[model samples]
Target: MAGRLLLIWRLLVRDLRRHRTETLLLLLAITAATATLTLGLTLHELVARPYEQTRAATAGPDLVVQAGQPGPHSLDALAPLTTLPGVTNHSGPYPLAFLALTAGDTTARVVVEGRDGTPAAVDRPAVTDGTWIRPGGVVVERTFADALGVHVGDTVSVAGHPLGVTGFAVTAARPAYPRAGWHLPGSILTEGGGLVWVERGDIATLAGEQPLSYTVNLRLADPQAGAAVIDPSGGDARFRGWRFSTGQEIADTNGRLNAPAQQALMIGSWLLTALAVVGVAGIVAGRAIGQRRRVGLLKAVGAGPAMIAAVHLAEYLVIALAAAGTGLAVGWLAAPPLFRPTAGLLGSVGMHPPPLRMVAAATALALTIAVAATLAPVLRAAATDTTHALADAAVPPRRRRWVISLSRRLPIALLIGVRINARRPRRAWLVTVNTLITTTALAAALMALAQERSPVDLGYSKLPDARDERTTQAMILVVCVVCFLALLNTVVSTWTAVLSTRHPLAVTRVLGATPAQAGVGLAVAQLLPAIPGVAAGLLLGILTFFAGDDNQHAPASWMLTAGLGVPLAVVALTAIPAVAAARRPVADTLQAGVR
Candidate 1:
């Protein structure tokens, strides 16, 4: 048994080394799918990580309460909540001044909050750059600072009062920039802008007449009891006219911000995997044709069907494992940049190894695709009779009377193209499926671009939505990858067709067909399948992405472009290999076929 296993390993290694190009192609197909899958599966956890880190580092609050009305005495109403049961520690009803801020030529509405020189027991913002707030100096929230392109030494004006930028900080106490808190002197329905921190005295000095609201951050002994602490059913007057939020609610909101990106990646990964399956099946079919004689040779040496199957399976199993590892590493490294952490969170988005479950899931997917593709071809080859396998004769193409009758009336190139497709209907379908996936991805990308053109209303002003921006980016990325794999698949399928039909095409060339006619015939086979694929893909893409969204519509121009462009692209890709095969010396091809 040990000796047989050793022999199988040697055979697998030698076979892979001999077909290095095919081996690499298999690896590329599987790795592309697996890497995308890894990114999709792990992105949500990665996006939520910074918030958790910030919460732990800053001793973030369990509950935050904001006064509904702004006045100098608002703190008097909020002060007693710090003494409520389950409130272990608290940061007071700090004064909040709603004002417009200007830095350089850019201006935006901001919430300027007053803080002490020393850190508060709860909800202390962690300074990421420079120092904490000081006299005549103001700290900017990290995300807001990024938007303004300001740093520690720069100065920004608050309600027209210029203050030197003291430092940059991140906090779990509020949602990231562009949503720091609500704008004041209006209904809280208005969109909030950014956040800046200054000393208590500066707040009174800078806002002589601006309305002031108060907010208190509370750290509960039991974080989950936040709802009970602020229960309105108690009829406590202090709870009235105050907005309260729990830590869990805030974390959930932060996580929701990444929902668009996560959905795009998850959907894209499945599309890519489908394309990979079609491509791998073609590669396996082509390799099986070339390996028939090898199967016969193994059988002659007294190898059983099980051993022969094992030998073929081992080669792909090794490649699958390698591809899975490479994919996991690529996905893990690529995710942080693609996610592009918003200035809202505390920690820099850094590379962390994916968790063990993600690694396992990606590996399992790769192995499954490899095994599924290779099994049918391996089993068929093993079952071939020894005599027929040793002869290595081409399987005669089954002639259909209707196909023959129809082909006889067509032009020579069209006749040849139609017959080639009829001979291998399965290959034609694979080409169709490949084109379908590519066109669907292209159409989805166009739809996303169309939606981006519409303005997003934020109640206060129109601004680009961060979620929409990320979703658009993710779609673009997925389209690029799917197109590349589709391109590779096109080339591979065309070349495989050329090899399989070499004998018949050579005979036709010898019988008076021009080389150009033969090449065009080969390209026509691919083009025919692509037409239906393109049409179906466009319909599917529109239904999948554009349905139920009143703001989004399928642009006719975009649909027409994809419907016409994909088939042309397919013809162009197929022509390279087709022309090369047609130019091969007819005599040599005929001689090889006879052997």
Candidate 2:
């Protein structure tokens, strides 16, 4: 068995060396797939730690209770419940007041939790950049600090109070929400509204001297017991209740109150990974014909079909390992940054290395892609007889021959491109599938951009200052990336297609067609089948929105235009590469193809 394996390795290495291009592509693909998985899975554990720590420290409450209307006692009543079965220690029938703050023309609504005077309490927030809250000073969540461009000692006004910014900190308490990669939730902070720490006397007067409301934070005897308390409370606010969130949920949500961004990023990773797998599969199958002569030769020798297949498959496995390894590293590095844009939303101000599980999962995905893409062709090569495989060189009959015959009287360029493309329908199909995958990726990216639900200050939606800028940034990123990939794929596809079909194009030239005409003909062929593909992709995208949100199904004119324009753009973009490849010295290309 060892000797057989060695022999297969030798054969695979030799073939892999011969097909360096495909081997390189396999490496690139594995790297991409691995990177995406690692980033998606590990983001919370690695990148979201600061936010988690901040959330835990500030909230110190096991269940934060609130009142529907303003009354201080609704919070005080929770004291007896803590004395109930699972509960033990508790703090703060503390005042949590929400207020709208105005700093010059900029305004923000802030969620404020009254802090206990002591620094070392169980739910205490640790100071990060400056002194803790003094009688007249407040501490702001570090993430929010970074956003509001405020620091310790920088003063801002909230609800007409001139507050002293005494500190920047992370608390298990009040801070900005966490956001997924798809969006950012804008945040505003101050001394409890700039770090305005009012000695107890000023609290009610500053809060509009407003009607008072309060809530308590309890620390359970067993932290897990807190969840049991939370579940039963969901149905009614009559006991007027509290919902308990787990460490992980809190960590996840630490990035945002509603983690739409994280969910979007995860889905985006999965969707792109699927498209990459499909594209690679098409490319692998397209290369199978090119390997036929080699397959036949190996079979003709005493080598069994199994060894031949093993050799082909093993080549991919070797590359997959390297690619997966590389991709995992890239994912680890990228994950931290991916979360950077939304860090303020999470309330975290620290960075953590990704957990081991995220790296392992990503590597597995990369190998899966390589195996899934290459398995069929490798197996097919092994299953064939030597003579039959070797003798499989009969001229591929012209596809849709009758149709081409009928169109022969048409313009030279269209006739030639159609005839050649028809002869190798599978290659045309490979190109088409590649195009579709590109379209799918572009669409997913655009959707991510368009659907961003980043957080903003509550009730500030109608405010002049509130802007969903992240969504705009995401849109520009998606468009730029899609355009670049579209241009890149168009050129490469045309060049590869033209090179693969050069013999036919050369023959057309021999039969009396201009080189320019032949080149244009190649573009025509790609454009024809691509029409339906682009249209279908557009319809799918539009339907996706409708399916995802029945209300969003309103007819969109731009989608239709983009869908129609993609194929036309593909054809136009392809012309330069096709023309360049076509103008290559015909005799030289024919000689190369012959060899």
Candidate 3:
């Protein structure tokens, strides 16, 4: 038993050292998969935990009532809500007015709130920087301040009235900016703006009797029952164009601010995971074919099938373990950049370690992909007959009259490549799958980026929906990484193919096939499979993205271009490696072919 274990260990170490580049590529593929999965699985917890903490710290309101009327006493309409059932406490009838804020080169539409110098009982704004609203100063909302790059002591023109920035504050009375305005169900607001606070004494200076809306933050005994009690009529039956927001809804809004980005992360992660599996599988298959002689040698030395298989599998297991660790660390670091601090809280939230279940799941997936792809090839290689293994020979080709007849009609180089592919159809399929995964991810990303409307395009400088733009950016990131890795896989797979076909290619070269022709033949083999793969990937991308999207718009023509371009790019990428292999000394290759 000890001797068998020692042999396996020696084989494992030797193989790993001999194939350092292949091992590195394998690690990167697995790392990408696990890192993306970790981010996708834990996004909810990352976004929600900090929001809940912020909500608790700010004493966020249970219900927010917006009363709009064309009069100075518009707040009087909401006075009746103070007497409503389940309304345990109330904060305001604070003045709400819309105005333009100009800060240097930037101009933004802002909703200004009038508050007293004293803090409220229901919804308290947590001041992150500077001081609260002073007599002649304005407190900018955190998100708004961040967007405008304005800090304390800077003067901002609010409704054309210049005021010194006193501090940055965040409130739970509404979901941050852009969404600060009331959005009717199924009806997006034509315009959205951010929020700011000023002392009651300064309200008249900016508002000037422009018929402000009055908002009251209410604390309820049963916060969840807000919709039932607050909006009984479900229409303007309560107040003219009035809206009500429940506490739980506000919490959800804050927590799901990055819903679009999180969605992209999840979708991209799954696609990348599938690609990772294909890449590792291809590498394993290629490695197994290349190492047939090694397998035969082990068998001749009296090593059992179990010991040979263990040696091959152990190499991947170590790489898988290392990949998982690298991925976890990357995911942890990557998550922080996705979530930026908003006005509601002063400090950035520290990244809490993901739950044990998430780490376990990610690690298990990485291992499964590594082990599963190689298992079949390992078993097959281990079971090889000693005679064939020692001779380093393939099984006799089945005689096909049609193949011989067809070869005469094709160019010599293409004929040679076609014959090679016919011998190893499974390898061709693996390459096809790799291109398919890459194209599909690229298509999805292009579609996502196209659908996203930037905040500036919508005529708002600082809206809460800015998170949606961030989501699109994340999708682009995923696309770039997936495509890059796919390119690397192409290079590696080509190199492996060259190694496998050296002797056959050399014979063709000796028989008068030019190096360029040999290179074209090799590239054609990859291209033949790519045609079907590209088409399938396009369809797959369309179905995946459209099925998940609420909008049913047809994909643009450019998307097709991007999808079809991937396979072409892969064919082109194989050229250098193929040419390099073709130009290798024919005499040496033919000599090496002999057992």
Clashes of each: 0, 32, 1
| RMSD versus native structure for model 2 | 5.7
Which candidate's TM-score is highest? 1
lDDT of 1 by residue, 1-595 (tens): 9999899889988988899988888889889989888777666666567788889899899999887788866767777788977888989789888777888877777888999998888898999899999989999998778767898899898878989998999888888767676565534654647889999889988887877788999998888887577673756675565677888877777777678788898899889888888888888888887888889998998988998899888998999999999888887778767866545766533445677888899899899888887888889988998889988888888899999999999999999899999998989999999999999999888877777454334333445566777777788888988988898888779877987889889989989999999999999988988888999999888777765546476589878988888898899998878988899999999888632
lDDT per residue (tens digit) for residues 48-130 in model 3:
66666666777888788776453556657788788888888888888777777888877877778889988788888888889
Worst 10 residues of 3 by lDDT: 182-191
Using lDDT as the measure, the top candidate is: 1
For model 1, which pairs clash?
none
- After superposition, candidate 1 runs with Cα above 4 Å error: 68-77, 83-85, 104-106, 183-190, 230-238, 452-461, 552-555
Ranking of models by TM-score: 1, 3, 2
Cα RMSD for predicted model 3: 4.8
TM-score per candidate, chains pooled: 0.92, 0.79, 0.82
Whole-model Cα lDDT of every candidate shown, in order: 0.83, 0.58, 0.76
Candidates 1 and 3 compared by TM-score, better number = 1
